[model samples]
Target: MGFHSFESPYDWSRIDTYRRRAEQCPGGLVDLSVGSPVDPVPRSVKEALAAAADDGQARGYPKTAGDDSLRQAATDWFRRRRGVDLDALGADLVPTVGSKEAVALMASLLHLGPGDRVVQPKVSYPTYAIGTQLAGAQVTTVDDPANTDSWVDLPGVRAVWINSPGNPSGQVIDRAGLSKIVRAARSIGATVLSDECYAMLDWSGTTQVGQNVSIPASPCILEPGVCGGDASGVLCLYSMSKQSNMAGYRAALVAGDARLVKAMTAYRKQVGLIVPGPVQRAMRAALEDGEAVMAQREIYSRRLRALVQALTAYGYDAVMPQGGLYIWAQARSGDCWADMADLARMGILASPGEFYGDSHRLRFSSTISDDQLELALERLHTGA
Candidate 1:
């Protein structure tokens, strides 16, 4: 009841009120709030989906576990990008319709109810807590999710949610920080779910500090240094929405801990929650399209850099994040809603910090179109 839900008037309603105010500005609204991708879907992914549909492969129901090719592509991605070698049999990997549902349904899938507790980051993707509540489980939050002692020691803690290149903050936890969490959670028999949806979008050149893991972006929970190569109760969720511009395709996967994945697969099948057959093929193409992913990263990097510069000049304390598709910045006004009001005056709409549990800063998404971003930047610079 303490947290906002739709029935209780979720933050979106409040944010929307601000949005409407922005829409009334004489210059017209240039939305910098929503993180939906405006980029084109990778050519390879589109080709694969079209091929599947044209070949009549989309006529039947999809396997909830995902086809072997889709699952294998996931494992291969883990090995190539995450530097983590999952099970050779690859039963540890399973496709998800999209990472959001997987995240929202995680606690329910585990059948966790009232006496159980789920720990999540104070400012993270909201679905983690939503899922816990849907399962009738208690929710706890920590400022630093990778600090195991902060939540792992809590009584009856059954799950800990970790988001590297975290939402709203874009902070990445290195291997040592994550390893401590993994070890502590495992010691107490709690499941650790790492949301790595933005894994491929790091702008921070931060290293794995004390480890030799050559991960492409953020250090993954399934990495050897973090999990000690044993995925007993770890689950890493990856989404292609941002990187491959495949949000509409709902392509993503859960990989790690064969038993956990196997159990989730069973439950998913019962509910008919399978990725469409065409989407499954598209996911395979997306995973294999490293060039497209890298290209998208370059595009976002430029936009984020430009936004940071423009915001700083416009009296905001701005900097490129460690990783993720957002610019986390604090405005001259100090108050988040006040900053939103200031942006609204310029016909710009950015997410108020309170929407993501942060009252000190607003989030500007890099998923905007370049011309609109340019207009937003011009407005900020001129204080028009």
Candidate 2:
């Protein structure tokens, strides 16, 4: 009931202060702050959106639970892209505006409040904490899931967030590691919600897609291999923003735990949180085209290599991102914002580590255009 009681993890003040300075910069700022993709949406997706918009029936109110065709596409995409067993997931598939909203609202839908707690990574996307706070729940930050010590003593914890190829760290949780956490969560009768928005971007050399790979670099929490066989209290939140460049379309889905999905769908329907007709069309088109997603992945791979090498040359040791469009790096000396300021002065602006609950590290995104990426590399080399 109290508005000011909710605490946000992000440094809203600092971000606003930085925004002002970035606006005045010479070549306009080379923003690598948020992981928003800047690439153009695929033509297939665009064409679909336009066609849906021009349809006479599209003018009416869209279905809150998503159209049958969109749901089927979501079903197919998970089966083909993530290797999730549709039968195992059961009736637990529902559409959302995007993964961000789904991730944040899941806490509330579960009725987590006051005494309840949510466990999340120490270095995590800020929304995890914000979501818990908004639900009137406590947040516990764990550095690694393999540490059983961190799992005990949190009796009131109802959910544990697992972000593979994590947002800020780009660390992939393998099958063995995932099994440990899933077991721990299940033991406590808690749910394991995996934010796998970046699961399609694994880059550990062996391709998770195409012809050669056996196991994926990033394992899904609901994967039979990772869960040792059940998706009991699990859910995977995914978005088309990253892989398909559909950020503006707000296309995403929640899959797993049929009961949970039903509850969420009811709540969402009551609140009118539905994807637009045209956006749903675009999502279906995007999911149907695996080639476009692969092409996008290759582009990110090249940019990631360039950024990692350049950051190393700039005297920063960057963690090799196993997947995702980010490179986590640490400056040899001083705080990360100081490092960010240095980069900004050199004409390249990187997200300060502080944003992701990390003080000593910085994140570089590989979502820029080729020319901008080359310029960023050049600036890094000259320390401009």
Candidate 3:
């Protein structure tokens, strides 16, 4: 097998090993390398799941395309949160195992092959590129989707990915900026897949607290006017994992372009890729309750403020995150591992920027507890 090694570029096992080493330290570790929310699920959702589990009907084979209630809930969510009346999405709506798996499988279903190009962000979640490779498509990294010049000349580019509230960088593309990319891609007949998984966590209010500046959250490809009434060549992927602390539930959905989603649904039905019945019920509860989502946001917001201020005070150049759980920071001394090693010595673990894309940067997560965060502040002060 002349298999190309997409797995080699990312070493999750190596990353885990480093985290384990830090965990073994006497003081215990504040593991911020992974962005898994260490928060409790809303009681409403938990109860909903429990109720669904006991309904007896859930024992039957789950609806592979998603249940009617789940699809309707997704539609209602789009109208309330996204400012779009998307009735066409109901039949097209299919609950995913999770957004990551949805993205990975999307390329294969789209029929991308060896010569096709899958354009993605220069610094991205890595899954986008890996998915493209799985379908034998080439990965083209576009540093800025807002800039038309960055993608105007790429050849054979079948699909372009835009991630708002980016994973490692925490950058968000504004409406006008996103409009430009959608126009450019549409002109060349390329599909745009916008990953707005972290759109719910906007931290724009705390930028001026210190030397760092926070950017505001903005939706790019989903802008109704930019997408031209019909979402023919556009799609938006979102997950309840971050917003609702339902990462283990594997609940997520892709909305947009009825035709595209319908094709995806057809392929998915054959493959048995569906969110379990109980998880779908849980997602419905999670989506309908706005208060619970905001409460979770507050938890992350408070932690972000403390960590951003602490990193700046410690002489590390912490680039205040615009949105999302990560703060992209650079070493004042310009050595990435030196900074990581320094933090690790104090039992604070962070993901190196090299894992995302470029070297010489590091990412800190705001998903830790308040108590652990305070301890991290102390470690930062003492470690440096």
Candidate 4:
């Protein structure tokens, strides 16, 4: 029941009603409300998974800490792609079922509970609050995390969650802003968990803060500049779901703070939260295939361009996201439900901002197929 205190489920009946209404249109429905990938899996990843499965090694229980190859691949990925150097063979990382599992369990594994506080962005992925509440911890929403001073002094604050190329908003925090939050959290003895799942999908190659600029993907919590090359009291979570179209494989990992990772590994082992061995092997293959990842990014980029052009022509204020898979946009009237109705009438469906702690915008995902995207664009153009 306490979990219900976090937030109510989205009005799916409303979505269903809209779905039925939209189906009556000649173009059918183009659901851009969710970011689930519609593309095919990379051949390398699929082959690797098939090979591992044929080997029949999955009959045995897999290690909760993941195998050495997987860990090393993850380390190499951070260094090569994210500019964060993690230990190649140390107990500083562990594979997770998915980033969602890690996000939801981090608070509980850290032993946060009643009377403690978990600070998360006011407009964020809903799971942050759910995880805190599941741990019996209170949630403190921070509207402007760039202003670290606002949350640093909050009493009982035990953990802070930061998302880059943030969901819903698609805003990437700069290196200096991340450093300030990390420093503030460290000063108060709280752990900072940076969710960098969308780090590699940065639309803007560089993040600009005034005149100073840095690679958008390199401002991770584990980045040397962000944490002074010290991973103490900090952790970074990443997922291959978005980057590699491996969401069904549940491939994700948490790295940073050897002690913290070790503790999480031990707890997860006892609780049977292990990644499938076959999935682990597939993840390794996915991490090593940089070409496939880049190609996928370009596909999404094209879709983004199409959506922005069409939405702009329709008189909607389409916010060009710096990164991530979704386009955050606002109706001229600033009424999300009105926008939702308009979209439904055009046989389109987008996630309303109300679902992500905002009430005046909608999120359009770029993960749809090229044909589906074209249909959505045509509808937008014709005001169908």
The best candidate by lDDT is 4
Summing lDDT over every window of 10 consecutive residues in candidate 4, give the lowest-scoring window.
207-216
TM-score (all chains, Cα) for each model:
0.94, 0.93, 0.92, 0.94
Worst 10 residues of 2 by lDDT: 206-215
TM-score of 2: 0.93
Predictions in order: lDDT: 0.83, 0.79, 0.78, 0.84
| lDDT for residue 210 in candidate 1, whole number 0-100 | 20
TM-score of 1: 0.94
Off by over 4 Å in 4: 1-6, 9-14, 88-91, 207-218
Better of 3 and 4 by lDDT: 4
How do the residues 1-384 of candidate 2 rate in per-residue lDDT, one tens digit apiece? Answer: 221145654764665556556556666666667778889899999999999996642898788778888888887776666666756646468889998898877788888889988999989888888888888889899898557569656779799998987888888887778788888888888988889888888886533432233334466777677665566788888889998998878899888888888888888888888888888888899888777887888788888888888888889887568888898887556687777666666666677787788888888888888888877888778776
For 191-308, candidate 1 gives per-residue lDDT tens digits of 9999999988876785542223343588888877788878888889999998899998888899888888888889889878899899999999998888899899889999999999
Judge candidate 3 against the unseen true structure and give its global Cα lDDT, from 0 to 1: 0.78
> Which lDDT tens digits does candidate 4 get at residues 64-151?
9988888888877777766766753232889999999999888989989899999999989988888998888999998978788888
Worst 10 residues of 1 by lDDT: 1-10
lDDT of 3 by residue, 60-152 (tens): 878877888888898777666765567642224678999999888777778887898988888888788888888888988878877778777
